[model samples]
Target: MGNIPDHDSYIAAAPEAFRPVLNHLRDLLRGALPDAEEMVAYNMPGFRIRGKVVASYAAFSKQIGLYFLAPAISDHAGEIAETGLTASKTGVTFPPHKPVPDHLVKRLANASIKHVDD
Candidate 1:
């Protein structure tokens, strides 16, 4: 708990207050980007490959923010409306009480990866 050794430790070290959502995001990203390297970038848990950042997840005071290097929410307008995500320029936010739907997360992440690859 002193210093987060890596992504897994960062997620593990998150406060009990934010564990569930953080864990869910961790699981989702790991499943989606199985070969991506996990690192702490800008002090957040980040996933990347070939020097391009794909996605990162963090917990705010009362919400979870999943950020992508490319703009992802625009590609997911329908899902955003359907799943109740409060989107930002490069990411979307979900209430800690409401876990983000798995399909939406994968879609956004795949879009982000494609954006980086392109």
Candidate 2:
């Protein structure tokens, strides 16, 4: 796809390719950080609030990764297993070719926000 200037543009430009995942993620993030500001950071889609980086999203070659602002992978170890997330200290990667589970997104979004406060 073409180079999208911002998150909204990026998602809009690749609607057919990114609609389902992007929309789901967007809604979840909004729910988690109701007043967070949307912006493009690090050349990717991101959310922030009162100067804190709340979350970010990226569409890579083979997968999409949603990164939390803090490191809390171990906190949700059990749930992560059920969600089949490939995680790192700051985020979980969902293979692009696969579908993103709704429950997993909710759990992760909650955990991520909690991590921000912790």
Give RMSD to native, each candidate: 2.0, 2.6
Ten contiguous residues with the weakest lDDT in model 1: 1-10
Clashes of each: 0, 1
Off by over 4 Å in 1: 1-4
Q: Looking at candidate 1, what is the lDDT of residue 6?
A: 75
User: Candidate 2, after superposition: displacement of residue 15 in Å?
Assistant: 8.1
Q: Model 2, which residues run further than 4 Å from truth?
A: 1-5, 13-15
Q: Provide the clash count, candidate 2.
A: 1
TM-score computed on alpha carbons, candidate 2: 0.78
TM-score for each candidate, following the candidate numbering = 0.87, 0.78
lDDT of 1: 0.79
lDDT, candidate 1, 12-74, per-residue tens: 777777887788788898888887888887668889878888999886666778988656667
- The residue pairs found clashing in candidate 1 are none
The digit string of per-residue lDDT tens for model 2 on 1-118 reads 5655677786775436656687678878878777788887767778887777778777766677877754545676667667677777777787655655766666666666665654
